[model samples]
Target: MSAVHEVAPVVDAAHAEPYATRDEYAGAIGRIRSAAEAYYAGADLVMDDAAYDALLARVAATESAQPGWAASDSPTTTVAAGIAGGDVEHSTPMLSLDNVFDGDELASWAARLERVLGRPANGYTVEPKIDGMAVAARYVDGRLSQVATRGDGRAGEDVTVNARLVAGLPAELARPVTVEVRGEVFMTDADFERANELRTGHGGTAFANPRSAAAGTLRAQDRAYDAPLSFFAYAVHDLPGGEGLFHSAAMAAIADLGVATTAGPMAAITEPGVTATTTPTAATTDPEATTTSSPPAGMPLCATIDDVLAAIESLGAARGSLGFDIDGAVVKADDPADRDRAGFSSRAPRWAVAYKFPADTRTSRLVGIEVQVGRTGVITPVAVLEPVQVGGVVVTSATLHNFDDLVRRDVRVGDAVFVRRAGDVIPEITGALLDARPDGATAFMPPQVCPRCGGEIDRSQKRWRCVRGRACGAEESLAYFAARDSMDIEGLGDKVIAGLVRAGLVTDPADLYDLDAESLAQLERLGRTSAAKLVATIQGSKTQPLSRVLTGLGVRMTGRSMSRRLARHFGTMPALQAATVDDLQRVDGVGPERAATIAAELAELAPVIAKLTARGLTMSEPELPTRPAAPGSAEALEAPRLPLQREDGSPMTVVVTGSVPGLSRTEGNEAVERLGGKSSGSVSKRTDLVVVGDGAGSKATKAEELGIPCMPAEEFATLLAQLTAVRLG
Candidate 1:
């Protein structure tokens, strides 16, 4: 809602015509209902507001023309069907509001309400339409009793714990009263920035928008993370008596009870038969309707549509400065009795309507389409656009998401397109303006090779990845390969890895083995002495255990623990490479799907493994404890026997707990691996032995419970010494 200025209606050509058949109306209603359900569930909207409004308008017009033909559960007649998973039933249904986009639609809605009331409807209150999750908090006596989300409008999940964590939400009321207060849970801009920062710091995916962030945070079962959320009570219902208070009075009472309400006072729209052309200056408008820099102390009264329009314009102009995001302005009947008399539709109140602002969009020319390779080797197309300002941000490029999205939008290199930012970090092209398409524009074809590495592309999946694997994601892969848990190559930090990739000195992990002091010194900031040390570090990493090497490979579904299990099970790179899908599935953590993926990946790494081995890297497990030969047996002459083996002469599954006298947990695990035994972090029935060290905890107790043999730290040390003696004998 803005100043009452006469402007032509911006009609959508596609939906300008009225529905011609009952089937068309039915189809439109069904689509709208599905979209509303998804939107309420915090999922991506199936259709944008504009398109949805057009369809809704069509359905409404159809219903008006032929009331008998309207479906019983049509979107126009019913609230969104609540999503599943709610555990708490609501006392009453939470309804949706009808939306009007411009002055013409607003006038039409106002005129309809007047006809229903049999008089010029007066006393309207306007407030910001917060874009957030709707919630209801029930207070018994003075203490907060329960909180629930607006699930399907009828019921919602109990979120009392999470709700109490939200800032500005009061746990107790000022006076003892039993009531249910409805409000919005939202994240401010600063809150969104900090939340995303924390998420990215912990390597979690960042939320796309504030509304989504609020919804996810509110619905989380664990209230551990310091998630920032704020709430504003909009409406309150007193239980038992069930009497509704006036809109302005209810908001005031909620605020008095220590709950924050929407910013700005309720501006009354009381003009009778006011058309879009009606205009009034400050002199002609009510003195009470004069605007203020900040929200007034209480609700302001507007005597004419001109005053209402001015107030809306003022709010719209101040939107960017507001702490929370508002999608539109809401107009409600000021008098509670008037609202009740107007009655309710199945889904919405007939006495109120929301006037949505136009979407923040800008038309810009698509200069070109550039495909960028992600760390996972997914090739995403970016639209290079002529610089355009959208939502106060200068957007030069927009994401196409993927090739499929690119084709679905049918955006072309030389076509004019509309860009929208919304809450996404990156702007996106809403759609191509086909009317402004330049001649000779053609559909974009995905590249046959990776744009960065010129490697073969795998198009079998929804997102195309490089057949060269991590080699195509060079720098990131190199960093992971050199990480402490992997190759443990000291001094190979992000800056060093970035310089190496940029200088084209490295492409694959094997290239690290080829670097000498002279080659390393050529990198900026690496002195001769530093280069020598780096070279030595790279040389030393070649002998890091097989598990470390596997972890460095960056295989999908394989991490430190899984890598260790695989190395222990296979015993050698050649053995693991030769593993069939069925063979891989036998390993502890590998499922059928994961087994197939590992098998296929290992096949691809065959050549890379051969190269690393050729470069002097370790390719097989070290010798394990050999079985003692019976009197004068050939095995006794072949190899020295060690004492760490089980009675059956198989390697023991040893669980080491607490502090060893001189060895760290990692060192102890490494020693076990070196002795041809599997080191486990937990004790189980499968464990052959448990090594108990000082301050031994639950693992030691569990070992005793399971009747697994226990060895003290001194005994384990003596056993290692005996193994060493046999190896040297």
Candidate 2:
């Protein structure tokens, strides 16, 4: 129940302005609006939630100082800062709850409620505040009719079509009575992983967090496949059969009608003598939906403020194991009479207050700033921080994303800076705690030349990249070239590649083929025997198909699958290099931007490609029956379909997980493609088959859960061999 200590304001922070001037105030307003819109739209958020709250607090303080200066459209006067707009009006305004950061604040809110009620509240209900998008589901005769988002608390966009796919939100309630259920729509951890897998498999970027995934999935229509979503009702807005019920009682009723409430698994902690009541729910047949069979730990019924705080603290402690994100705890007057007495404010209800936990962020000293060159030559500034625990991980370094973000945050070496584990995964420097800055702390200077190759910097994009691209990151490119999924060169690990780069023995991947055992043995640590093996492995890669070479090349905007696609489409390196952007786009999943980037990358790597060709390396893909004659050329007739083709000639989406007997993961994927199947890394509803191997882990379990067909690795290997033998004949 202890309150997190307050942080002193930073003097040099980007949002440090006091907003005393009109221009400064206006700037803050604009920034808040932009951030809110991006957040609601499930786009990349400009600032973390903690930073946004701080900025909003500053604006609030300023507005309170000069009440006359506040405008009608001021963000303080609107829900979500007035960013959301929609056509569907809510039956009642879905007001947001005011936040309480500490026990003292919580006490003050309770006191205010007591004053309004003219007596102490009979009871309080505390529930975990699910971190998700808010939506209102309208039911007619106990059947789900429409679902809308909580846009501006007044109206929202209709999302009934997508909502029908969500789990926990039953299509029909137990009783055939009308009601408007207000709840948070969210993705569970498993759902997020599955969703990301599905998105990336389709050549789309993964969502940053579960909240973003839930928001995007809930709003998306016409998706090729449904991403799993879960719902938990917090309020029943219009209950036809139930009126003036206590808040806790209403939640219990909602649960009985086959809806999951925030009570979740922990089931509510009851007062000393009261036994928790079990809520009834109908069994669900929907595979994509979440089902709750246990009685919701009823919103712990709290008779006192201390009891409420205890319930909140208990929920916070169990946060990590909840299997979903809960940003805070919501405390509300349980008695309907008390809520009526307290009434509502313009923006939020007075009967409820949210006690937000300190965000998964901490302050640590920025010991140093190091520039790391990415595989694609993007220069990223990494903050070397004094080890600090964030989101349960000891974070020693955090990404600054780019120079612009580094500058915007104004983080300097030797300063105590704010580090947040973005999405509970990647540690990122959100901003600097400038008030704690040490004397003589200096700002970081962005590199004018590429850190690795000293090449010219391309400042055209926000992410600073080297003009030489992959060539500037020769060490990375060479390692990638020798990777298991690419050239399958066993002896050329990162250390060996680094030695080659450092000794000036290799400037590009092609140079690896030129190293003799005698020349390689001269490096600091390499023995003659090891060098010979390395040389032999390098030479062996020359026999690999053009698809492997293309994969090794690290072409921009392309991956192993895209390389395979390009190799299968063009067959020869010369044909691919000569293809225009339009020709590249003709391949599945490639758009104009990606095609143009690939075209440019191929052009830049022409000299290296020629070197590989001169070395007698394979420059052509395996001869397939369906290779295109030319871009946009009509096929004389449909070429014979391979064994793995579906009835309509489309390739089956096959996922190969774990280790296949006698075949590497790369080989397994290649075999799938050769047999006329599209190999996918993730298992989803759309996946036609899963080839399970030893220790297949989660993907195997996921396949079983989804009722997808699975074949043993040995069976798949035998089938692939038969297909390959038939193709060769």
User: Among these predicted structures, which one has the highest TM-score?
Assistant: 2
Cα-based lDDT for every prediction: 0.68, 0.75
lDDT of 1 by residue, 1-729 (tens): 010001123345234556888888877777776666655655433444445655667777788788888777666665553233377888877888887766677778877888888876667777777778889999899678999987767778888888876655677767687889898877765566566566555555455456666777888765346677777666788744446666777776666666666632422211211111111111101110112122221234454444455456445554543545567778877777778789887778898888776544456789999998755466778899988665557789987766755665577899767665543235766566555578999989889788888888888865678887676788888888898878889999999998888888888889989888898898999999999999999999988878889888877657676777677778789899988889998776566767887887777777778889999888664543344424245654455434555444455778888777667676677667556566776554557888899989987886775568998987877767666676678
Q: Locate the minimum summed-lDDT window of 10 residues in model 1.
A: 279-288
Instruction: Give the TM-score of each candidate.
Output: 0.46, 0.54
Per-residue lDDT for 335 in model 1?
75
Error of 2 at 485 (Å): 2.2
lDDT (tens digit, per residue) of candidate 2 on 1-729: 100112333222223345778777888788788778867876544555555666667777678777766768877678878989699999889887777777888999999889888899999999878778999998899888999999999999999998887777878888898998998888765676578768766666556556767888888867887887877788997776568899988988887787777664543222211222222222221111222222232378889998787677656655544556667889999989888888898888999998977666556778899998877787888899988766557889998767865765567998766665523345766556455567998878999899887899999986789988776888888888889998999978888888888889899988888999999999878899999998988898899999999988888667787888889988899999999999998887576667887898898889999999999999999755463344233442355656667655667889999888888887888888887788876665557999999989988887886678999999988987787687689
Clashing pairs in 2: 167-289, 267-297, 268-297, 268-298
lDDT of 2 at 423: 30
What's the lDDT for candidate 1? 0.68
lDDT of 2: 0.75
| Candidate 1 structure, TM-score to reference | 0.46
lDDT of 1 at 466: 84
Candidate 2 contains a number of clashing pairs equal to 4
